[model samples]
Target chain A: MSEAVSALNGQSFVGIVKIEEAGPQGMITLRGDAGAAALQKAARDVAGVDMPGIRGIAAAGDRAIAWMSPDEWLILLPHAQAHEGVATLRTALAGTHHLAENVSDARALFRVTGEPARLREVLAKLAPADLHPDRFGTGEMRRTRLAQVPAAIWLDSAGEARVICFRSVASYVFDLLSVAAAPGSEVGFFDA
Target chain B: MLILECPCCGVLADETELAPGGEAHLKRFGPGASDDEFEGYLFMRENPRGVHFERWRHVNGCGKWFHAARDTSTLEVFGTYPAQTTEPPRDIRDRISARRPGWTWREFA
Candidate 1:
């Protein structure tokens, strides 16, 4: 069996904000009522983590769950265990009004980390979300559009941000980020 | 260029991310209803110049349908609420009344 490579294949651009692929990680789309005890227990049983609350994230070791909506979440795990994780969730959530699907292959993710202000500058050029640390701080996830492409973005505890978009737009997103993160493209600011 | 807030996910979605669902609070007059009632429900629209309630779906954000109250002419948004209700919330109506004093849209004065 051939191993799958990252969407960007370790592509990196060292700039004011470091732009690089976040490696091959598991991405699962989970939909269920997080408030339901049965669903919470089932999620823990399958992903070894609790369901994240509204706009919140719950992490345990290598696994992390990001709240996508009221009844939806995105679970990230080790890439190799993605399929098994989906199967496990399906079996555990059977007969419930819930859906658990593996989207690891369908989506590509990029990590942007550096000074919070500079990082937000690059993202502000594409995404419309207010990236102020006070409003969108650690552990908050939002599914929005980036340069007209759908993306799910979340900030981690370490202040690094993961921006995930469809595989088809991975290259476009990467290229956009590269230019946005360039040293001199700072909007409204020029060399004195 | 309109920005609508989704009550479910609490995301302030831009016009590109949201799909307009047209006039809200419609009374469905289906099968066995009078011709006038059916016509009123299907063809008639209360497109007032001010204080109009509308339905919007956050297609790119949370994929949840919501409601927004705005003035058609001025484009001043009163507020946004969940789509589960049949009519505009009282607070939204009061907000509109306070801004456009004596302006009546549908039912509220």
Candidate 2:
């Protein structure tokens, strides 16, 4: 294994919202016919979890999967398991019209948790998707732009948002989130 | 800022999240067609004052391409539909007719 450090290694920001890298997680991009039973079985056999439905996420132990588009899903797993996971999936899906790429190095992930209302305000400024819990609660995922950069966002069970952006723009996303989470920077409705 | 709902994902995508795809339901004039036919298909577009149909892609959302019907003058959206069909859906046509009386665009009257 190559010794590749994370983009924000040894760096973390804290304020009303705490921002930090989610460690080294494996990411895989899965694309296929969602309704096909064979694809579903293969995904479950390889990832140890059912593929998530539209705008939904399914978590099984250490692995989690998020629905990105109609026929696309993002699978997150332990770094050590990514390689084996991809090979297993490829074999399982042999002769099928599908693609399973190991995107572990393509994306950077951050976990953001804080005052719900404050976090909502910050996300609203960057993304157009409604961050209100009623609209974007747990299990729901969206592929949207954050500050002109493409990202995938979703809330965990604890209401903490997991923001994933391309590795190339990881630093920019981190800085933008830090600025938004800074003290006294959160613009309340009355202030707006 | 115009917001068009993506029929596939049901997301009300903002103009920034969506990419405009010019006119919708256009027929192609390929080989064996007259020069005028090909030219018309390639360049000519219906720039109406009201009740226009166009294509849009939810670039930052579901990444699905869809169609939207709206009035060019007022910016009032009639509705959005899937891109699989060759023309706008019946329900969207009815909605446009209800809003703009006696408007004619394509086969919809």
Candidate 1: pairs in clash: none
Q: Per-residue lDDT for B46-96 in model 2, tens only?
A: 989999999999888878899999999888999999999898788998888
Output the worst ten-in-a-row residue range by lDDT, candidate 1 chain A: A183-192
Give one digit per residue, the lDDT tens place, for model 2 in A1-192: 886566676357887678787767798888999887878887888668888777888888888888888888888888778889889888988998889999878888898887676767767778877776667778888888998888888877543788898889999999888887888786773122
Tens-place lDDT per residue, model 1, A78-163, is 99988999898888778878888889989898999876667777887788777666677777788888887888787774447788
* Worst 10-residue lDDT window, candidate 1 chain B: B100-109
Residue A83 in model 1: lDDT: 92
Residue A73 of candidate 2: its Cα lDDT? 84
Taking all chains together, each candidate's TM-score versus the true structure is: 0.90, 0.95
DockQ for all candidate structures vs. native: 0.72, 0.69
Worst 10-residue lDDT window, candidate 2 chain B = B100-109
Docking class of 1: medium
